[model samples]
Target: MKMADEGRRGEEDGGPGAVHQVFVVMESLLEKLKVLNYEEEILAKHNMKNLSRHYFVSSPFLAVNPGEQFFLFTVIAAWLINEAGRPFTAPQEHDEPNATVSNILSELRAFGVKVDFPPSKLKSGQESSPNYPAETTEEESVIEDDAELTLSKVEEEMIEEPDDEEENVMDLEALKLRTCPTDTEASSKPEEILEATVDAAEWSLEVERVLPQLKVTVRTDNKSYLDRLQEDVGKTLEKAKERYQQASGGVTERTRVLAEISEELEKVKQEMEEKGSSMSDGAPVVKIKQSLTKLKQEIIQMDVRIGVVEHTLLQAKLKEKSNMTRDMNATNLPEPATGPFA
Candidate 1:
C-alpha cells in the first residue's frame, strides 16, 4: 500500500515531470475494468460502492479498507482471466489470501507475463495484483497484431490494380549519372593548358537554336482570373451560409435558444447547490440517530412488559393448581364420612 504513497511523494517532490509506474499500471487496469463493465457486472451485482478512477491506488492517508480492496482485486482478476479465455474460479471472501494471490499470479503467467514479485506484494491488492489485467491486454494486443498481419496479406492478394506512384518513380541512378560529372571529366592533365574548346560563332548559333525552346510564354487574363475567383468566393459563401443555417437555425433564433438553455442551466445549478447544502447540513443524520435512540428505548420497554406478563401467567397457573388439589382432597374425605353416617 505504501507503493502508491511513495509514488505520490515522488510526484510532489520531483515536480510535474515525475510519473510513477504504479500509477500507470493502475490506470491501465482501471481502463480494462471499464471495458469489462465492472460497474454493472461486479459493483451493481454485489451492491458495492462504485470504484474510483484510482480505486486500486492505496495510500495510508486514505481510509481504504484492506479487506474490500483484496476482495475487489480477486473479483477483477478472476473476471480478466475469464475474459482472456481462461477458466478461473471466482474467489470468495473466505478464500485464503495467499492462495488467491497465487492463483492470480498463475493466471498472469499463463498469459505469458513474468511475475517477479512475491505473493505478499499482491496481498495489499494494489501493488502487483493489477498486473493481471495488463498481461491480458498485452496478450490481446499480440493477437490483434497477428490478425492485422493476416488481414494485410489478404488485402494485398486481393488488390487488382498496380500502384501508379510506384510506376511513376524515376531511375535515381540514371539521374545521378546525368547530373554528376565523371571522374575523367573532372580530372585534367597537370601540364595541359586550360582553354575554351568551342568556337564563339558555333556556340552562339547553338544557343539561338535552344533559346526559342526555353523562352516560355505564360498568358495572364485578369478578367477570367477575377471571374473564377468571384465564382469560387460565391460558392464558398453559399456553403458557409447553408452550414450556418443547418447548425444554428439563424443567429437570432440561436441566441434565444442559448438564453433559454442558460436559464435552465442556472436553475439546475441553483437546485444542485441547494441539495448539496441540505445534504451537508447533517439534519437527516441527526433525525436518524434520534429515531434509533427512540427505538432502543421502546425495545427495552417492550422487553420489560413481556417479562411482567410471563411472570403473572406463571403465578396464576401455580395458584390454580394448588386450589384444585385442596378441593380434590376435601371431596374424597367428606364423601366417605357422609355415606357411613347416613
Candidate 2:
C-alpha cells in the first residue's frame, strides 16, 4: 500500500517525476525477489523482515544505476522471500527449463517454510455450536424443500444422459450458454484475499510513468467535457429524430401500398368467381388463384421493407436514448462558477 500512498501524494502535490523514480526502483527490487505471488505474504515473518533489511543495506552495487531505486526494491523482495524460508527461483534474464510452481513449493517445504492458504474464519452449519444457532422450523422446512428440488433436478438431468454423440454436442452447446465472469473478476479476488492495497505514492508514480505512453489525459476541466458531450448528444438526438420520421413515413407508405394490392387481389378474385359461375369454367378460377398468389408475394415484399424500416427506427431510438442519457449527466454537474480555470 506504500506504493498506492506515494501515487496519491504525487497526484495531489504534482511532483510526479520524483515519485516515478522511487516506484521504478521499488519495482525493480520486487522483480529481483523471487516468488512475488501469494508467497510474498510470508514476509511478515520475523526472519524474512530482518534479512530483507540487511540485503538492502549491504547491496552497494545497485547504488548508481538509472534504475537504482527499482533495483533496491527487487533486492528487498528477494530478501523478504529468503527470510521467510520460501524457495524462490533466483530471477534469470533468460528462460530456464524444469522450473515450475510445484517445484518451488516442494523446495520451500524442504526448508520448513509454511506455504499454504490462510485459515478460514467461516461459521459452522445451521445447528451451530459457538457461532450460528439452530434454524427455525420454517427455515428448516424451506431448506429441505430446496434440497429436494435440487436433487430431483440433478437426477432428472442424469437420467437424460446423452446416449448419442449428437446429444453430447447439444449438451456442450447448452453449457456454453451460461454466463462466466471475465479475467478482471478472477484477478480482483486474489487482491482481496491478499489484502493488498497499492501505496498511493507508488501508484501515482507508476501512473505518471505509464500514462504518458497511453496518451489518455485526465479530465481536469469537468465543464468543458460536459459541454462537448452535450453538443454531441444534441446532434445525435437531431439525427435520431430525422431517422424516426423517415422510418415512420416509409412504414406508412409500404402499409398503404400493401392495402391497395390486397384490394385489387380481392376484386380480381370476385371477377373470376363470377366468370366461373356464368360459364361453368375452372380456367378463370385457376387464373384468379395465380393472380392472387402474385399479389400476396408483392405484399410480402412490401412487408419486408416495412420490417427493415422498423428495425432502423428501433436502432435510431436506442441512439437517441444513449444521447439523452449523456445530456442528462452533463446537466447534473454543478456549474464551475468560482475557479481559476472557470
Candidate 3:
C-alpha cells in the first residue's frame, strides 16, 4: 500500500504533466502555422507515417504513438529552426542535389518536411573568425589562491590566539553585558526554540491526517475539474478563431464590393464630364446620374459595415488573448504535481 501510494505520488509530481508539456509546446507552434492555414502542408512535408491530417492538433498527446510523436517533434524542430534562421546546417556530406541554405531542410524531408525558406544574412561587417577568446593564466590563479589561503590562515590565528595582556583587558561593565546567559536562561532558550517545534509537530500531524484525503482529491476532483476546464477553453478558442476568420472574410468581401462601386461611380462621373453639354437631356446621362448616386450610398454603407466588422474582429482577438492567458494560468500548474499514472 505504501509503495502504491508513493508510486502514485511520483506520477503526480512529474509524470503526466511533464509528458503534456511537450504537447503544449508543439501545439503553440502548430497553432501559429494553423493561423496561416498551412498546418496540412506541414504534416504532408513530414510525411507522417499513420497520423491523419491535423491529428496532432485535434487529439490528445497520449493517443499518439511514440514513434509518430518522435517524428512530429523532429519535424516541428526542423520547421522552427528554419523559421528562426538557425545558424547550423547539415554536414556537407548530407547535402542532396543542391548545396545551399536549404540543405538542412532536405535532411528532414524523409520525415515529412514542409517549406524551406532560407533567411537572408547581413553582408556588412561580417567576419571570418571571432576576434577574441578568453585566456586565463595558471600563475595568476595560483597567486590568487595562495593569497586567499594566507588571509584565511592569518584570520584563523588572530581568532585562535589570546591577545597581549593590555589588548585583552576589557571594561567590567561591557564584559557583564557581553557574557552569555546562565543555565536557567539557556534552558529557557531551548524552550523558546521548542515553541516553534511544537507548532511544526502539530502541523505535521495534521498533514498526516489530511494526506489521504488530499490524494483522493488530486486523483479525482482536481483532475476532472481541470480536464473539463481545458476542454471548454479549447472549444472557446476554436470558435473565436473561426469567428475571426469569418469577420475577416466579411471585411474583404465588403471592400471588394466597395471598390467595384467606386470604380463604376468614377466611370459615370467621367461620362458626365465628357458629355456635359451634349447629353443635358439624354436618357443615358440621367441613368448614369442615378447609378452614381446609388453607388455612393452603397459604398458608404459598405465602409460602415467594414469598420464594424474590423472593430468586432479586434475585440475577438483581445478576448481570445485574455482567455488564453487565464486558461494557461489556471491549468498550467507547477509541473510538480504527482500523478498515479504516468
Top TM-score hit: 1
Compose the digit string of candidate 1's lDDT tens values, residues 76-119: 66766675557889888766676666677667765556656666
| lDDT value, candidate 3, whole model | 0.45
In order of listing, the candidates' clash counts read 0, 32, 12
TM-score for model 3?
0.18
State the TM-score for model 2.
0.21
Error of 1 at 269 (Å): 88
**Weakest 10 consecutive residues of candidate 3 by summed lDDT:** 128-137
lDDT of each: 0.66, 0.45, 0.45
Off by over 4 Å in 3: 1-220, 277-342
Please, what are the lDDT tens digits per residue for candidate 3 over residues 1-342? 000012333356767554344335344434454543345645565554433333442233335443344334334434444433334332222222122222333333322333222211100101211000000111222333445555566556656775753564445444333332124554566434334344664455344434433332223488889999999999999999999999999999999999999999999999888788576658887889999999999999999999999999999999999999999999977676568874
Off by over 4 Å in 2: 1-220, 281-342
Lowest lDDT block of 10, candidate 1: 1-10
Compare candidates 1 and 2 on lDDT and give the better one: 1
- For each candidate in turn, the TM-score is 0.37, 0.21, 0.18
TM-score-sorted candidate list, best first: 1, 2, 3
Q: Report how far off residue 256 is in candidate 3 (Å).
A: 1.6
